[model samples]
Each structure stands twice: as structure tokens, then as C-alpha cells.
Target: MTTTPPPTAGAIDCDIHPSVPSIEALLPYMADHWRDTIVQRGVHDLETIAYPKNAPLTARPDWRPAKGLPAADVATVQAQALDPFATSIAICNCLYGVQLLMSEDIAAAFANAVNQWMAAEFLDRDPRLRASIVIPTQNTEMAVAEIERWADDKRFVSVLMLVMDENPLGRRLYWPIYAAAARHGLPICVHAGSAYKHPVTSVGWPSYYTEDYAAQSPAFHNMVSSFICEGVFAKYPDLTVVLAESGFTWLPAHLWRLTKFWRGLRAEIPWVDRTPTEIARDHFRLTLQPVDAPPTAADFERLMEHMGSDEMLLFSTDYPHHQFDGNAVLPEGLSPALARKIMVDNPKNTYPRLQ
Candidate 1:
């Protein structure tokens, strides 16, 4: 393990998770009817629906508590995530299972409650802490409404959605959400997780957690292709999308493959005038946590060369998630200039509200 931390002082940490303790914590934020329904029906906790909270991979041992959620409150997050890494500002991307509920109305209620709870519990408590507004992608109107509600609050920097939603995110059905995000200058942050509406893999259901986890990279590829081929960038030119915990080592190769196919299929998708790589370069930014890179520093440098741009990677620790050991938040072989770009410049450029 690396004993020396990265030169991360005053860095903008892009993807730290603030776990909701339980469904009970959000009850106060929900509407009276929804709260009553939840109580009457004896609703179970949704905390572990996305990923098993107690799993070793879910949190580092030192970050986890003996009993309760990993990042249940702001003070603990400050101590474990912010102070150690010397993070100047961090965006709280809560990964509760609000997106997993089948009922659209229930999902909307929970999403609203989550956003409300985020504002009151996290954003309001710490000036340095910002958050992504959790929206229910199941219903477009409700999703837009949620964005509008939090759009004025500068602390809520982005709109959060699960990568594995019911439909490919770039389908016109979800464009309204993107439109709202663009209008408000908020980036759409897609995090790795599943709603379980379909099998995690395209072929069939996976039996193990590892398979399901590995399947997320492919899901990201599909969504990025969806966004590019579906003319999302053409429609909303100023919009930006952040892929949190979406491992980026595969990006250069994926873009090459996608851009190559688009040349042959450009007639089918008339709106996608530019190559997929160009579109991705302009519209997408990815978090640096969970870096899937080659082991050697020289190999990693070659991978970065293939990427074509350093601005696409925003710095992140993926706080409380066992992504890296100790304070070795960054990968090796990064020059001080490149490290600064990833940690500060890229984040400021991606998230307009942060500036």
C-alpha cells in the first residue's frame, strides 16, 4: 500500500457517496401520503438494493462503522473522506435504491425525498459539500420537475441517474431531463448501478456479484453509444455527462470501435454528423476512481495517449468505497500538471456550478 497520498490539496472530488442510513431517515422528507403508505405497508430499507452495504468492496474497513451505514452523516464523511484527502469540495452522489422501485409514483416520491434529504442533511450542513439531485428516470415529467426544484440551488451541481435504467438514457423519452439539465447548466451524472428491471448482462442473468459488477462497463458503453447515435449532443450542444465510477481505461478503445462503426452507419443516424469520438470528447467527462488501467506506468502513459485528451478525466476518490489503498487516491505516472488538471481544472470545466 502507498503510504504517501497524492498531491490532492484543494482538489474537487467528483464522486463520493453519502449512504442513506435507512428508509426511515428519508421518511421526514417524503410527502404525508407517501410517508403514511410507507409506514402502513412496512416498507423495507432500500439501502442495500443497489449493492450489498456490508460487502468488503462496498467500503474500506477503516471507513466502515461497526453498525450502520458507511457514510451515514456529514461529520464522518468530513473526517474519513474530506480531511484526509485534503478535498476542497466534494459532490455527494448518494446511491440509495430510489431508482430500483417499480412503481413510478413511489419512485418519484422516494427520489424527491432523497433530493430533499440531501439538501437538508448534507448540502445545508457543509458549505464545502455539494450534491447531485437524485431524480426518478421512470417518469420524465417528474424527473424534470425535480431538476427544476433544485436547479436554483448552486450546491446541487448535477442530476444523478443509474446507468442501467429501463431504457437507454439517450432515447428521446429522457431528453427532457437532459434539456432541463442543460438549461440549468448542470451536468447529468450517470453512476454505475442497476435498477434490476432486466438482466444485468445482455445475454442473461449473472449468478455472482462479480459478473454483475463487471457487466457495468458494457452498460456504460451502450449508454454512451445511445447518447451519441441518438443525437443527444446535437440536440443539446452545451450539455455534459459525467460517468461516475465508470472505469475509463476502456474508453479509448470503445470510442475507436464506435467511431469506426458510425462511419458505415452514419446514413442510418443522420443527426450524428461528427464521429462518435468527437461527440464523446465534447460532451462526456469521467471520474478517475476505479481506474482500470495497465499495471506499468509506461503502459498507463500509452493508455492516456490513446485517450487524446486529459480534460475528460475528473478527479475522484470514490469515498468509502474500497477503490484504492490509504490516501493513494491517484494512479501512478501522473505529472504534477496532469494531476492538477484532473483534480481541479477538469472538474471546474465540467461542472459549471462549481465555478
Candidate 2:
């Protein structure tokens, strides 16, 4: 947040979205069967719970393309996000509808088509761009297969997921997907969202999108807890995990509570030898957009101190989704060194391919 620090030159934007133009654009990447299935059934694009196409928060007014959906093309993305921010490298995380289906096979097919489309349309066009390998969380087998398909591409730096999934992320059933990702040195990027398979709350669904958005903090807590207690980091010590668009202001208290409880509950999970905070601090990284810090810079600094690790944050504009006014994006109160870490060093460490 040091405003006078060096400009974001040679910096990495860890999360910027490029909206999928249309279902038709993905047809070329789809398998023949799915292509026929879609046409035959007259299936429309599945709207994602995370970002509705027309939602106010989905696209900043100025960033919207004149002729098409916001960020639906490479040129618009470059002009709006990359060029203006002086970003040297921008990682595109497309939040498409490939994961909303009940049928794992169809979901897998669409996920495949989406990744293929991303490679062909985005990554292939921009040398400065990298992308997350979107997977069908419904089927771990297909998910792992998708990972193997793009694992060798240094441009596909991480595996993306919604914060809430069909099951607890720490379950052993999901470990195969994690194993494959770790094998390829891909961090799991859990964005703030859900498939809406279940109600967002423990009791039931929420009344509105505002509730859903604010509830993300708790969801992230449970998600991180599941990963820690389930021994994901313990199992894959070298792996990194990124919480994209995840407002991390709540992390300090969550981790502190978990660690305090962990001491008494040590016997339940012997494999989790270290405290939850230590493990999470070592393996987890978060995006900096929508930082949700205190109003004053001093209070924000106090929260940063509470987080205990400088490496936990990686910079992101959350482009096309306005979290700040034009150009004055960096949060205030960070020391020159921490600002550099968030903008450059932390991301490079989180994503090995970035180096």
C-alpha cells in the first residue's frame, strides 16, 4: 500500500478475469458428442453463481467493451487491465459455467472445452498472460485427467476452483486431484464462489446476493480448515494454494481460533503434527483485491501484523470488477518491502513458473 513505491512495472497481477464470450465460441473446442448434445438439447449458457453476466460487480463500467461482453476479447482485456496497470504478467481466471451441471460427464466435457478455449483464445494470444487450469470438480477422475492434459504448459500456472464445492476439499476422495496438481507444481486457486449445489448457509439458502457475498468469509474459513485438518499440506508439502478474490481480513481470527483448539484436539489428527496456522501460513497465498482492510491505514497495518506472515498476500486488481478507483489500487500502509512482496516476490514464490 506504499503509494510512493516503484510503479507496478514487472509486477504480476495474480487474478484478472476474462469473461467467456458465448457458448458458441467454445463449440470448436468441444467434443463432437457434447457439441451435438448441446445443439440437440438447446442448452443455453449456465449462469455462474459467483458472477452473473450483468451483475454490477461483474464488470466495471469503464472496462466494458463497446461491442461485446466485458473482457470477452484479448484486446479489451489488455487495454483495460494490463496496459493501464503497467502489468508485466496477468493471470487470467475464467469463471465460466462448466461446473454447474449435475452430470459429471457433461460437466467434464464442458470443463475440457472451456480450458481448450482458454488456451486457444487467451493464452495463445498473449505472451504476458497465464491462466488457471479450470477443472470439473464433480468428477475427480476427469479433473485429474484435465490437469494431466495441461500440466506441462507453463502458461497454465494453477488449478482453479470455487471456494465451496460438492464436497469438503480435504476429503481423501478429492486428494487425487490435489495429488495430480502437486505433481505438476500447480497451486490450487480457490476463488470466492459456489456451484449452489447446497444452500450457502448451514440452515438454508440466503435471501440475496449481498448475504452470499458477505458469507464468503465464513466459507473460506471452513474451506481452509478442511484442507488443514484433512492433511492436504501435510500430504503435499511443496504444493501452494491460492485463495482468489477471497477477502482475507478474517484469516487472523480464524487461524488463531483453529490453532487454539488444535492444541487440545491433537490426538484426533496425528498426521497434522503442526498447528493449523503454521501449515496454512506456509502453504497458502491470497489475492489482494477487495482487501476488506480497516478504513484507516494504521488499522490496516495492525491487521497485517496479526496475519504473522508477509508471504501470505499476492497482488491482484480483480480487473473488470472494480474494488478501487482508477490507478490508486494499491492498499495504503504497507512498507516498501511488503508492497514489493505482494506485487512481485510473493506471487513468484506462490507460482514457481512465474520465475
Best by TM-score: 1
Provide TM-scores for the models: 0.97, 0.96
Global lDDT of model 2: 0.87
Write down the TM-score for model 2.
0.96
Q: How many backbone clashes does candidate 1 have?
A: 0
For model 2, what is the error of residue 55's alpha carbon versus the real structure, in angstroms, after optimal superposition?
2.2
Q: For model 2, give the 10-residue run with minimal summed lDDT.
A: 1-10
**Could you give candidate 2's per-residue lDDT for residues 1-355 as a string of tens digits?**
5545337776799999888888898889988999999999998886676676667787787886667678888888888888888788999998887777899999888888888888898899989999999999999999999999999889999999888887877888889889998888899999888888888777788888778887777888999999999888888898788999988899999999999989999889888999899998999899999888799999999999999999999999999886777876788888888988999999999998888
lDDT of 1 by residue, 1-355 (tens): 7566547989999999998888899999988999999999999988644567777779999999999988899999999989898899999999988788888899999998988888888888888899999998889999999999988999999999999999988999999999999999999999999888899889999887878888999999999999999999999999999999999999999999999999898999999998899899999999999998798989988999999998999999998888888888888878889999999999999999988
Clashing pairs in 1: none
Candidate 1: residue 5 Cα off by (Å): 9.0
What stretches of model 1 exceed 4 Å from their correct place? 1-6
lDDT of each: 0.91, 0.87
